[model samples]
Target: MNLHSPSSTVADADLQERGGAPATWLPAVAEGLDIRRIFVAFRRRFRLFAAVALAVLLAVILVTLQATPKYTATANVMLDTRKERVSNVEEVLSGLPADSSAVDTEVEILKSRQLAERVVKGLKLEEDPEFNAAVRKPSGVKMLLGGIASLVGAKAPNLPQANSVEAQKLHEEVVDAVLDGLSVKRAGLTYVINVNYESDSPTKAAIIANKFAELYLLEQMEAKFDATQQATTWLNSRLGELRGQVQTDEAAVQQYKIANNLLSASGTNLTEQEISNYNLTLSQARAQVAEDQARLSTARSQLSRGSSGDDVGEALSSPVVQKLREQRAAVSAQVADLQGRYGERHPEMLKAKRQLSDIDTQIQDEIQRIISNLQAKAQVSSQRAAAVSGSLGGARGTLAANSRAMVRLNELQRNADASRTLYESYLNRYKETSTQGGLEQSDARVVSKAKIPTSQSSPKVALNLALGLVLAVGAGIGAVLLAEMLDAGLATAEDVERRLDTSYLGAIPLLASVAEGRTEAPIDYVMAKPLSSFSEAFRNLRTSVLYSRLGEPVKVVAITSALPGEGKTTTSICLARSAALQGAKVLVVDCDLRRRTVNRMLEAEPEIGLLEVLNGEATLEQTITLDAPSGAYILPLSKSNFTPKDVFGSVAMDKLLADLRQRYDLVILDTAPVLPVADTRVLAPKADVVVFLARWRKTPQHAIEAAFRLLSGTGAHVGGVALTQMDMKQQTKYGYGDPGYYYAEYKKYYVS
Candidate 1:
C-alpha cells in the first residue's frame, strides 16, 4: 500500500504563504515562465527549427543558382566647384559650392529623363535586348501568372505593337528603365561624384557609365558657352547706347559754355586781367596825387613868406639857382671892400652895389620858374588817379558776374565727365567679354572611366543562404511560442495548484503499453501487471486519498472530473483495487448513468447494479459483483428508466451510500463529469470526500474551475485534485513534475 497525505513539506498554508498576494491568471502565467522553461521549450522544439531552416536554405540555394546574373559598373566624375574664372568681369554663369542643394541638383541632372533618353538614343538601346523588354525574353513571374490564368480559362494580355506612337512611348519606357538602373552619389565630403549603372552585360554597363559621364561634361560646357554668348550680346548693345550718351553730354557742355560767355581771350579770362591792371593803375594814381598835394602846399607856404623858390623842391635842386647865389655873394664882397677904401658917394662903391642887385634879380626869377613847374605836375597827377579808380570799380563788377556763371559751367562739366566714364567702362567690359567668350571651360570633368567588371554583382550566394537560415529559425521559434501560448491544457501538478487554488495530491503516470503503442483497457492491465509503473502510480494515488483528511481516513470517496474522458472511471477502479490490496474491504460503485464505462472496463455483464439497488429492485449484495483478481467488489451502472438527476437526488441513493460505507472499508463512487451533467453534483454532497480528476496537459483550466464551482455549489467537500495519464518522459523533458526531479537525481537507483 502506498498510502500518503498531502506532503507536510508543501501544505495548503505553505502554498498560500508562498503565493503572497492574490494575482490574476495572466501574472500566474508570467510567473510560470523562466529562463529554464524557455531553454526547455527551445530544446523540445529544436527539430522543428532545423526542418524549417533546411527548407529555407534549400530554396535560397535554388534561387542563387538559377537567378539571372547582373553586372554593375561605375564611372567617376570630378565636380570642380572652385571654378577658376580667368577674367575680372562678373560671370553670368558660375559654379556652385558642394552644399546639399547643389549636390541634389547635380544628382537630379544625372538621373533626368532627358539625359537618359539621350543615352538611349546614342546607344540605340530602343532595339537592345537588355533595355527593351519587347526584344527580351519574358520574366519567370509573368510566365507563371500566364500559366495560372490559362488554367483558370483566362487569356493573357498581348504586348502592344511598335507603331510610331508606340515606338515613342516605348522609347520613353526604355529611358525610364535606364533611369531606374542609374544611381548618382557624391563621394563623401568631396566634389567628386560616382555614376553607377547596372545591366545584363559587363561591357554594356561600362559603356553606359562612361557615356553618361561624357554627356554630363558636354552639357556643362554647352551651358557655360551659351551664357557667355548672351552676356556678350547684351554688353555690345549697352556700349553703343553709352557712346551716344557720352557724345550728347559733351555737346551740351560746349553749348552751355558758349551761351554763358565763359570763354576767355588768350586762353585766360580778360575780366580777371583787367581787374589786375586797374588795381595797379589806381595805386600809381594815388601816389601821384599825394606827390602833387605835397608840392602845392610847399609852394603856397614859400609864396606867403616870400620864399617860394627856396621851399620848392625843384628850385632847391636847380643848378641855375646855385649859380645865381654864388654871383650875388661875389657882388656883396666887392661892395664891402669899396666902402672901406673910400668915403660916402664914391663912383666904384655904387657900381659894386648895382652888380649885387642884378644877381638878386636872377635868383628870384629861377625860384618862380620852379614854383610854376610844381603847380602843373600836381594838376596832372590828380586827374590820372581819378581815371584809374573809376576803371577799377567797373572791373570788380564784371568779376562778380563771371563767378556766378562758373556754377552752371561746373554742373555741365560733371554730367559730361560721368557720361564719358560710363562709356569707357562699358567699352572695356565688352572687349573683355568678346575675348573670353570662346575660351569658357566646363566646371566638371571625367576623372575615371568605367571598366568591364570580372564578376557578377547580384545573386550573392553565401549571403542569401545565411539570411535565409536566420529568418527561418526565427519563424520556427515564433510558431512554437505561439502554439504554447494558445494551449490552455494543464501540464503539471503545479498548474493545478496555481490555477484552481486546490491541493495536488499526486500524478498518475500513463502505462507504457497504452503510451507507446495501441490503446488497451488500462483497468485489466493494472490488475494483470501489478508491479508495473501504472499500478505503482495508482498505489501512490491511493496513499494520497487515505491520508487526505487529518483525523479520519476518507472511507467514502467520489471520483469525478471536469469533463468526460478524463480518466475518472479508471482512477476510481484503480483506487478500489489498490485499497483492497492493502487488506481493506473496498467497493467500486459506478454512478455515471448516462455513459457507463465501468462495466466495459470490468469485462462483466451485470444484471443488477447500483441503479437497481437504489430503486429497491435488488439488495446491496445482489448488486455487488466481486472481481477475483483485484479482490474488489464492483457495482456497475445498469439501464434505468429515470434520469441521473432524479436517481442520484433521491433519499434511497443517500441511504445506499451510507450502508455501503458501513460495509466496506472504502466505498469509491465513480461519478459522471461535473461540467457535462448534474449526476456528480447530486452525488458529491453525500460523499465524505470528492476527488477531482484532471487529465494531464489535456483539460482546460477554465473547465476544471467550472467543475469545482458546480461541486462546491452543492456544499461538496472537495479534498484535492489528482493529475491523470501524465507522460513521464515528456514531464521529465519539460522539467514539470516529480519525474523530472527523480529522473535526474535518482535514476541510477532504478532499473530502466
Candidate 2:
C-alpha cells in the first residue's frame, strides 16, 4: 500500500513537530517521452490550430488574386569568337577575350546605369507612367490617405518637377526602374548571354530586350571604329617623323665620307691596293738581297782561303773561270812531264813552267772578277729592298688613316639603315590601316531576337496556392506548440504525478444536468444518486484514502486546494457521506474560520460551530449537526472574528482531533485554500492524511505545487491529489488516460 499517513505510533502533535509527512511512493511511468501525450495536447487545442490555418490560407488567396501579372521577353546574344577578318592588320581595339571573366564583365555592362539611361531615353520611357512614378496616377489607397490629410488641414506632398531639388532624383528613379525590369546573365560555361525584360505589355518587353541587344552590338562597332581612326592618325604623324629621321641619317653618312675622303672604287680603296702591291714587292726584293749576299759571301770566303775560286759557286758557273782552270791544269801536267823527261835546266821544261804560271795568274784574276761582280749585284739588291720597304711603310700609314675614318662611316651607315628600316615598316602598316579603316565590325551578334510572350510570367496561381497551403500548415503547427507551452493548467491525472511529483488518487467527475434539466450541488447530488458516477467518484476517493495509509488507517482526511472556489467543501462533504454510506462512522469539520462555506453548503444554521467548540464555549455534541440523508455528522464553522491560525494551531484543536478520531471511523476536514489562509496549514499537521484538491483543467500547476509545499511544511500526510469538477463530456477529447476520459464509454456501469 502507498504510504500516505504518518506511522500508527506517531501522534498528530509529534507530526506537527516533525514538519513534514512521510515520503510517499511516486509512479515511475511519470517520466519519458509519450506520443499519446503529444496527441492529446494537439487534440485539446485543435480549435486554435484550425483558426490559425484558415486565416493564413484566406490571406494567401486574397493576395494572389489581387497581384498584377507581368510578361517577360528574352533575347540571346553570343560573343562571336569566330570573327571575320577583313584585313591582316591588327586593330588598336582588340575584341573581348573568350573567357568566363570577360563574359561576366559583359553581363555587368549590360546592366550598367549608362546602358539603362540610353535604353530609357531611346524608348522615351521617362514619359511613360509605367516607368515614371511622378507622372503616374495615384492609387486608390493613396488617394484615400491624401483626402484624409486634406480634411485634417494637411498639405499634399509636392510632386517632383524639372527645376525642383528632386529633378535628379526623378531621373535616377526612372533609370532604376528600367534596370529593375531588365535581367542579364551569361549561360553556363558559354559565351552566350541571356537578356530579359519584364513589363505589363508583351510588346514593350520584347522591344526593350531587342533594343538592348541592338545597342550592345552598336556600342562595340562604334568603339572599334573610333579606335581605328585614332590609330591611323597616330601612325601618320609617326611616319612623318620616321621619314625625316631617315633622310637626316643618310645625309650625315654622305657628309662624313666627304669630310674624311674615305671614298672607295669598286668597293675597294686605292690606298689599300697600293699597300698590297708594296707588300708584295718588298717581300720579293728581300728574297733577292738574301740570295745575292749568300753568293758574294761564298766567293769571298774561297778567295780568302787561297783556293783558286774553282770551288766557289759563282766561279763554277762562269765559263771563263772554267776555261782558265782547264788551262792551268794542262800546263801543270806539261811541267810535270818535262821535269821527268829532262834535266832541271832544260829549255822545254822552262817554257812549260812559264805557261803554268800564266794560267794560274789568269785563273786568280777571273775568280777576283767574279767576286767583284757578286758584290755589285748584292749592293744593288739591298738598295732595291730598302726602297720597297720604305714605300710599303708609307702605304701602311695611309691605310691606317683610312681605317680610322671608316669607323665613323660605319656608325653613320648603321644609323641610316635602322632609320630606313623603321620608316619602311611604319609606311607599310599605315597603308594597311588606311585601307581597312572603313571596314570595322562588331565582335558580338544576336543569336535569337526576343519574341513577344504569349503568357504572363508572374502571379502563378497553382504554385502560390501550394505554397500558401504549406505555410498554413506550418503556422498551425507552430501555434499548437506555442499554446501547449503557455498552458500551465493541470488537466489529467498524469499531470498531477508528473508536474507536481505527487500521487494521483482519482478524478471527481463534474455533475451535469440530466434530461429533467434539474441541477444539484455535488454533495447533495451524490447522496441523492448513490449509484451514479458522481457518487462512485467519492467512494473511490474514500477507498484511496483508507488503503493509501497501509498499516495505519486514515482516521482524518483534510480537503484543501491552492485557491478558493475549488469545491474543497463539496469534496469534504461528499467524501464524508461516501464513507458513511459504506457503514463507516463519518464526521465533517469546516476548519475555515474566514469563509465557513460548509455551513452554507449543508444549509445548517448553527449559531456556534468549530470556533465556539475550540473556545470551549460549546460542546462537540451541541456544535455538531447530522445530515439525515447520508447519516453523516457535520462540524461546520459560523462567522468568526478570531484569527484562524490561533484557533487551528491551538491545543484545543489538537485535543478535539484526538476525540473525533476515537468517536468517528473517518473525519473529513474542509479547510481554506493553503495560499490564501494559514488555517489549512495549521490544521493539516493534525490530520492523518491530507487530500490536496485540484480543479480539473482549472488549477494551474504552480498553484498545486505551492499548496503541496505549505501542507508538507506542516508535516501533513498528503494521501494524493484529487481532481475535482472534471467534465467527462469534454475529457474524451483530451485522451489523457484519466478516469474521466473513459467515463462516457463506461457510464453504463453506474445507474444515474
The sequence of per-residue lDDT tens digits that candidate 2 reaches over residues 239-274 is 999999999999999898789777762333788789
Relative to the true structure, candidate 2 reaches a TM of 0.64
Show model 2 residue runs off by greater than 4 Å. 1-43, 79-105, 137-162, 186-189, 217-444, 513-516, 709-712
For each candidate, what TM-score against the reference? 0.62, 0.64
- Model 2 clashing residue pairs (backbone): 20-715
The true-versus-predicted C-alpha distance at residue 380 of model 1, in Å, is 76
Worst 10 residues of 2 by lDDT: 20-29
Put down candidate 1 lDDT per residue, 1-752, tens digits, no spaces.
11113462244345346433222123334567555556666666677767776777778788889988888999999877666766676666877666777866887898888788889888888889777887877799978976786565433244333245667888788888898778888888677889998888999999999989988888888888898898889989998898898999899889987997777423337888888988888898899889788977877886788763655677778889878877878888888888999854899888888888887778888777777777788888888888888888877877776577777778888999999999898888788777876666777888999999889888777788788778777777776665555556766666666656677777776766224563566777666656656667788777777777779767898998898998888888887887677778999888888777887777676777777788788898787888898899998877554453488889998788778877989898899888878878888888888888888778876677667656666878787888888777777644443454354455334323
Clashes of 1: 3
